[model samples]
Target: MIDYLDLALQYGGFTSLDKVYLARKLAGLTDQQKLDFITPPPSVINAYFAEIYQKQGAEEATDYYLTLSQQLSLFPKEPSFAEEKPFVRLNLSGKAFGFAYVDGTGLAQVFAEQDVEVAENLLFEIAQIFPHYVVFEQAGKVWMKGNDFDETILMAEETEFLLTDVSVSDQFVKISGLNQEEVLQAAEKYDGQRYVAWSGRSAILYIKH
Candidate 1:
């Protein structure tokens, strides 16, 4: 048994007396037991924190970071489901695209998967195509290719935006700041017809039957 309370006080940013009391509470071992813990090698203490304290301290750690980010938000508005978990698994065609779960404050679980590297790459690609989509690895699998139609459209509009800008050509209306939503919307209009434009990041919307 490690003198965890003392360790916390000494190394965990707590006040001195607080450290002693906390250490006493955590170790529950007698003074002699605490003495053994206090002088134990650094590796032992580190292991204790990694395996035991880490999980125990997760809530506090999470809250601290969350509060910090919230204060920095330019337009700090709580999510609609702030009180609920932040993510939802994306399912399609009765086949699971991938598992998705949100956090306590409705913030999507950005990196909850197990295969972090692959999940990260997938997330990057999907973000360009759909900003709201998140990816994570779990048990050697990546979940969610991207956000669904509604989330994609909404996020695209929210970020990339859709606007009608001045067109150099007198006969055409230039759609500038076209995000995925605008693209999809314009795409929908030309379902049975063809239209074309000449200037944009990608091809100007050329809709065809």
Candidate 2:
């Protein structure tokens, strides 16, 4: 229900660099550790409370804020994965990737067992990294859907992404800007869970369900 990218861009005024920095820091820490950096101050909490109750005309505040706080990147995650489902589980035996950001792009936290945050070129570099990776599940695939993140984000808002889960070989995910070698290396990192079919300016991250 929460849009992670929107929170950062709209509420936090997060720059592309800020997002990358957060993702890099997040990839290393445990859940408890993550809370320390991401927890919004009283001002941010007040803004969210106002947005939900005062501005949006919500009847309640406490419960809503609790749920909202858990999903937002500015606030630390206290809830578990009960409601927030990941777009893709981390690849088997995959090592955690360090800081990596493309030009005018966001970060990619390719971690081991933990999710890869966002694949890049999301609403704002990695605009789709909602709460965690739930936004991607709620939105569209960034690379394959369109060349522009705004266009794709609008598309996600307008309609539901209908792509079904299938074999990794049957899928053709595309991440623009990566060369063939880089693409292959990414797939290899996912163990046998993902495969890169072909690449030009775009590479595939066909994840096995």
Candidate 3:
């Protein structure tokens, strides 16, 4: 039981004391039962927080809950396709941007540098050539929808940003520095269509269509 708690504490980043208490509580349960409790459902996490809130204070409970949530969210998601193989190198404006590959179902992954404008132009060109191929960009630490490259760049120039996901509807709220709502609004009005988001000052969104 203690060993199971140690494993759970290491795997889930739970506190040693908390895991030990949980392990002791479920001591008579089978190994599978212990495993299930350790890899708790969301409800279990919430319940744990509630218990902590009662024992500790709101601050401690909230902190623990957030930490648990962050750790859980870090669990890797199933990949959309098998490991990608680079089929070709992409060059934009005479500069080496990145590599391109056709994944499962003709979906393409474009691993590229953080040049938003160049990426947008190259993606547009790629789209014209491979209309059926869905293009995605792996830039820095963010996975982006291919079309949002330019919009993300413009947004970054105005304020701090976090590359949360590949969604275009995601807002680039003004966190600090000059609010570039006007600039972003103007860019949004442009004839071309693309989605974009930023991570701090770095552009992370890119798409080919």
Candidate 4:
């Protein structure tokens, strides 16, 4: 197995303090979990950097983009099974879900879906092999597989919020059961602690903290 911490320090371009923090956080994870957390698809990394560059500046995004590119370059390229046929079909609660294999790049491509649980289960299974970041859409809301940093924050009346959908990747959170105006009103209460963006019926709240 690779020493992820050493690799991060040598080539990931993280500061010494940041690498130490990451090492501590990743210390308890299983080998497979470590791989999953460290090795996301190049496309996903690019998309993340693009978003950051758009919001932040090139100076702010350069280190992350370079580090991620270096990390991916160290891994051998895997074939995308998505081009072939469906990798597996899952039947849950009288619903059919199709999943296409995208190598072991932590990319979970869902061909079909019924509920959030199904999507979560499929991604979890894929993680065992690819051990990378995964994303899917559920309940008309987009969800990305995240670590503990992305926590579940329950509000009144069964309203739920997810803080940071992609772990330490960003401070964006997902808000369900809230409309644009409602989330905006709630944001005002936060006193600029967060900003709300509309995604269909769901709201993506970017947290300052």
Clashes of 4: 1
Spell out the clash pairs found in candidate 2: 124-127
- After superposition, which runs of candidate 1 have C-alpha atoms over 4 Å from their true positions? 1-13, 29-209
Q: Write down the TM-score of every candidate.
A: 0.21, 0.26, 0.24, 0.24
C-alpha-based local distance difference test score of model 1? 0.34
Tens digits of per-residue lDDT, candidate 4, 103-203, equal 33333344444344543334333333222233444444332332223444423333333322222223434332234445444444332233223333344
After superposition, which runs of candidate 4 have C-alpha atoms over 4 Å from their true positions?
1-83, 113-135, 138-170, 174-209
Q: Against the correct fold, how does model 4 do in TM-score?
A: 0.24
- Indicate the worst ten consecutive residues by lDDT in candidate 2: 151-160
Give lDDT tens digits, candidate 3, residues 107-163.
Answer: 234444444554444543444333322233344221222232234433433222332
CA error at residue 124 for candidate 3, angstroms: 1.7
lDDT of each: 0.34, 0.34, 0.40, 0.43
lDDT (Cα, tens digit) per residue for candidate 1, span 1-209: 44356444454445775655654554557654543334324344335434542565533433433332232221123222231212222223232232222333424333322223443334334333223333334454443322222212221222233353322222222223344346434444333322222232432332222
lDDT score for residue 104 of model 1: 30
Between candidates 2 and 4, which one is better according to TM-score?
2
